[model samples]
Target: MTQPWKPDRGIRHAVIALGTCGVALVAAGAVLDSLWLLGLGTWCLIIAIGMELIYRP
Candidate 1:
């Protein structure tokens, strides 16, 4: 049987890093009561999702 297709290693690593940073930003935003940080983090998470959709199908 053929192996299933997979994303490139760099893409996988970048996605993971983006997710980690997104969570960290959210946490920092809460701690500092900063709406700007919260919004930025939210956008980061959304971009990660978009990338997955574009690349995984």
Candidate 2:
């Protein structure tokens, strides 16, 4: 029997990647004392949240 197809996984992968990068950036920012990087990480985190909500399992 044919199985049901699934949606593309690229978005999910991007979300996960961005999430991990954001976490790493946050840690690096804390260690480096760079507000710009910290802000960038915060934005990345927001994007990750949006991506997750849009692509819920």
Question: Which has the greatest TM-score?
Answer: 2
Superposing every Cα of model 1 onto the true structure, what RMSD results? 2.9
Model 2, 3-25: lDDT tens digits are 57656467888898999999989
- Which number leads on lDDT? 2
Question: Model 2: residues >4 Å from true position, as ranges?
Answer: 1-5
For model 1, residues 1-57, the per-residue Cα lDDT tens digits are 855765466677777888888999999999999999999888888877777777765
Per-candidate clashes, comma-separated: 0, 0
lDDT of each: 0.83, 0.87
Look at candidate 1 and give me any clashing residue pairs.
none
Compared with the true structure, model 1 gives a TM-score of 0.79
| Candidate 1 wrongly placed segments (more than 4 Å) | 1-7
40, model 1: CA deviation in Å? Answer: 0.9
lDDT, residue 34, candidate 1: 100
Weakest lDDT window of 10 consecutive positions for candidate 2: 2-11
